[model samples]
Target: MSEHEGTYRTFTGKTYSLYGINTGTNQYYKVIKKLADLFLQQCPDKKRLLFQIQKASVNRSFFKKRSGKNINHSLISFIKKTLRDSLSVYTAGVKHHLRTLPLSQRFDSTLMTKEEQYHLYMLEIELVNRIYKEPFKSSQYKFALLPHCLRDFRPDCHSVPGDVESVCKECTERCFIHLGSLLLKKYNIHPYISVTMDLEKLFKRLKAEHPSIGALGVACVPELVNGMRICINLDIPPVGVPLDANRCARWMKQACESSFNLKMLEALIK
Candidate 1:
């Protein structure tokens, strides 16, 4: 129902741009913007707002299930109003709302909890599923970028810098990182560890080498969100997988150790 100057249609019949999608319901977008603002402010009433938003979402879900393809302007208007009102709640369930939001759009690292970060990352993973279904099949040039945390940090495990990026020593047998590396090698996918957050630099190198590259990244929620935003800004198509759990020093108060569902990750390869 919308048109943009430079956009491409995906296999799913959805059109998007690395530039951006500028067409969406104004009311819906407005509510989203407002929620993002409140999130940044760390408003105290976030919980109450989240409760209302959740109720509205449930109602919307029910309606869609019962009346698929019967959506009307009035229903949309009602939903928007519900969201707007919910966001007005004072010092409420912000964490609950953050848990449901896709990528803490306005996430403040200073205020965000590890639990909220995990939820936001999960949302990003959900969005990746919707946006880049069967990504490996669609992307000609792809890279597998996994987090360094996935490395086994126990005794005798060691990692060192590589020619292009940090190299996984691949010391631990049967670990998720090892399995992920094997899968990438099997698929002929360029694999790298995101030790540095400067993806623009990495992508610049990738452009020089591959000319055009899409990325299949594995990271925690905050890092995933940060990487995705950078990719979007750079017009790079990326799909992502979140870690199974948060094991970073911030969350665990110790050295980091992370993993993912190898099966889920391999599914993206083919």
Candidate 2:
């Protein structure tokens, strides 16, 4: 994956790249590049640069001012052109692009303000999630893939691991246990902790055993995009509910409580 950095051609002769996110440093660029490479590997034949921008810490003026020398004039032009006209027009254009183009070509947020880019990204996620809502609701096997970062980062918040997924032992975080039980008992939605990093394998194995499987992922904006891509590639319809707030240790040091719109979760089941 690291080798995919710095203008590498894909197997299909496409000039794909894992573009840097709001940084001019080589190290940060390389880090985003690796993540983009993993995403591309999951679903090849998608010709576009994966913008590895974190929703919580995105720098809006990344392309506004040149950073040393690694400035991309064309990328700047693309964003400016897309956003220069009318605000409503740009919003509509974003929708059209997301609907028609592949993931990579759908966005070029290099020049947009941080808030604007985050808004566009959220729109894309919302649209994609809604597109899969019906299929997801009808799937035979439904899963609620919860992230470990959503847990309260407490010394006593120990979760028990199982062969398939981790069980949320009623520790410091009651939300996890609450949602897990609610999903299982009421909606018949199996709950899984996403920390094991075996999602692809687990889905593949379960898919082999079951005819159809769908998942409702609870994650931040970036993980939602990655998870949606993988689910689409695997032919598993998925709907996502972004966390109410990004309480991950990286973003918020003190508050580790996991929160989301319970209404949205219930709506998905309904």
Report lDDT per candidate: 0.51, 0.52
Q: Per-residue lDDT of 61-103 in model 1, one digit per residue for the tens?
A: 4645664443344533454544335422211333553465456
What TM-score, over all chains together, does every model reach? 0.55, 0.55
For candidate 1, the per-residue lDDT at 67 reads: 43
The C-alpha stretches of model 2 lying farther than 4 A from their native spots are 1-117, 171-173, 252-255
Number of backbone-clashing residue pairs for each candidate, in the order shown: 13, 0
Report the Cα RMSD per candidate: 16.2, 16.7
Which regions of candidate 1 fall more than 4 Å away from where they truly are?
A: 1-121, 133-136
lDDT of 1 at 188: 71
Q: What is the lDDT of candidate 1?
A: 0.51
Model 1 residue 249 CA deviation (Å) reads 1.7
